[model samples]
Target chain A: EDQVTQSPEALRLQEGESSSLNCSYTVSGLRGLFWYRQDPGKGPEFLFTLYSAGEEKEKERLKATLTKKESFLHITAPKPEDSATYLCAVPFTSGTYKYIFGTGTRLKVLA
Target chain B: DVKVTQSSRYLVKRTGEKVFLECVQDMDHENMFWYRQDPGLGLRLIYFSYDVKMKEKGDIPEGYSVSREKKERFSLILESASTNQTSMYLCASTQVNQPQHFGDGTRLSIL
Candidate 1:
């Protein structure tokens, strides 16, 4: 079974604070790793997709990095509007379009 | 912009009642998924469809079923609404291993 785990269940930060969220996965074959940001009372918004080791993608103050076994989401000087839950998912190469999701890390940015 | 839309922003159902949650995506994607989000569970996949009329059970599909009769529309059905099933339901669509675009979500409550 494909499994995903995320660290730091909850994070509180002052405005302009920087931090990183971790997403680790164990799967037979990794096709892609995805990061999403979900706000309260809304669905998740797509953030980044990391395909291969050493791959990285950035959007605004968020950067996502990928390795063989894990992915990292780095927030640089985040603002109050960046407060949301960050979710990570992995798609396996077993010809299934299913994605296994991590528990997610809730981020609260205080202004 | 590729947009995904859910039918309702909030729903209330009585116990033992059947409920349906609808989702539609404007993009011509090949895959669609339904997920339920709770406080600590992050997002749990209820079902996924790779193509029209093709459905697959996900990790937590026991109490839920899905229908994808059209390429742009997917619906999640709850056989019998339960208090435990109350949560925010999300819908997403994608092509293969690409990142998915999600709807805002439907908040369901069972009385």
Candidate 2:
């Protein structure tokens, strides 16, 4: 079965701290991976999409990198406003549009 | 910007009552999706539509049905509301092979 797992269910970082969140997957064929940031009581906001190994995308202080079996979301100089739940997702199959999502990593950046 | 709008941010319904959650996307995207998010479970697909009057069952479509009368709108209906169905319902839309854009979400509570 296709599954996505995110490590470190929760994390606390000092302002400007740098860290990476892991998203490992087990699936037949890798099509694409997505990253999202969701604040409490709000919907998820799209972050990035990585399509292949060695592929990377960045926005502001966030960077997403993809590999054969996993993806990483690296945060640089994170501020308190950057605190949110980071979620990773992969398509359920190569042909389908459905997605399998991870449990997400709750990140809190302290000032 | 792609704007996905959900009808409500919070809702309350009694058990055995029918419930409906609505979503609309401003961008002329061909694909729209509905998902329920819960603690530890992440986002589980409920239903999706590729075009007007077309629908597809998702991973967790039981006890729920969907309607897509128009290209920009998609509705999710619960046959009979249950406590287990209380969750944060999110709606998203995307173009083919593109990352999905999400709404602000609707938090539904069953009593």
Candidate 3:
């Protein structure tokens, strides 16, 4: 079965503190990985997509890196505005549109 | 910008009643998806549509049905609403092989 697991269910960091969130997967064929940020009372916002091993993408203070079996979302100098639930997902199959999502990591940035 | 619009931000329906959640995307995307997000279960796909009148069941499609009579609009219907179906329902749309864009989500409560 294809599954995605995210570590550190919750995290607290001071403003400007940097950290990385892990998303490990066990699937037959890796097609792509997606990162999203969801705020309270809102749906998730698209962050990045990594397609292959050693692939990386960045936007503002967030960076996403992908490997053969896992992906990482690294936050740099995160602000209170950046405090949200980070979710990672992978396609259920090589060419299918269905996605398997992780439980997400809730991060709180203290001012 | 891809705009995915869900019909309601919050909804309340009685148990055993029929419920409908609507979603529309303006980006002309070919794929539209419906998912429910819970505290620990993450996002579970309920159904999806690849084209007008073409629907596919997702991992958790039982007790729910979907309609996509138009290319940009998809609707999820619950035959009989249950307490377990009360969740944050999200709708998303995207082109093939592209990152999905999501709506603001509809928080549905069953009484």
Candidate 4:
């Protein structure tokens, strides 16, 4: 069975502090890994997509890296505005067009 | 900008009532999906459509049905609302190998 799991269900960091969030998966085959940020009372916003091992993508203060077993979302010097639930998702299979999503890591950056 | 729009931001209904949640994407994406999100559970797909009039059941499709009468529109229907079904409903759209774009979401409540 294909499944996704995230670590440190919640994290609290002071403004300008840096941290990393983990997403691990178990499946027969790998397709793609994705990252999303969701604010309270809102839907998720797409962040990055990683296709293969050692692949990395970056946006603003966030960076995402992927490996065979897991992916990491690294936040560098984050701000209070970046406080949100970070989600990890992957396409189930090539043709299925469905995704297996992790439970998400809720990050709170205090001012 | 790729924009996915949901018809409602919040909804309230009674148990045993039929409910419909509609989504439209302006990006001309070939794939559209319906997912129900809950805290600690992440996003669970209820259905997805690859093209007009084409639909596929997702991991949690019980008590739910979907329609994609056009390329840009997808709808999720609950045959009968239940308290347990109340959740944050999300709509997403994507093209081949592209990152999925999401709408603001619909928060549904059943009483």
Best by DockQ: 1
* Residue-wise C-alpha lDDT for candidate 1, range A3-94, written one tens digit per residue: 99998899999999899999999998788999999888999888888889999999999999999999999999999999999999887658
DockQ of 1: 0.88
The residue-by-residue lDDT of candidate 4 on A1-111, one tens digit each, is 788999889999999999999999986678778899999989899999898999999999999999999999999999999999999988776657777788899999999
Q: Which regions of candidate 4 are displaced past 4 Å? A: none
Error of 4 at B39 (Å): 1.8
Expressed as tens digits, the lDDT of each residue in B35-75 for candidate 4 is 99887677888899999999998889999999898899999
Query: What does the TM-score come to for chain B in model 1?
Result: 0.98
User: What is the C-alpha lDDT profile of model 2 across B6-83, one tens digit per residue?
Assistant: 999999999999999999999999999999988878888999888899889998999999999989999999999999
CAPRI quality of model 4:
medium
**TM-score between model 1 and native:** 0.94
Cand. 1 Cα-lDDT: 0.92
TM-score of each: 0.94, 0.94, 0.94, 0.94
Tens digit of per-residue lDDT, candidate 3, span B1-111:
889999999999999999999999999999999999888788889999989999899989999999999998999999999999999999999877677899999999999
TM-score of chain A of 4: 0.95
CAPRI class of candidate 1: high
lDDT minimum window of 10 residues, candidate 3 chain B: B92-101
All candidates' lDDT scores?
0.92, 0.92, 0.92, 0.91
Which tens-of-lDDT digit does each residue in A48-103 have in candidate 3?
99999999999999999998989999999999999999988877776677777889
lDDT for predicted candidate 4 compared with the true structure? 0.91
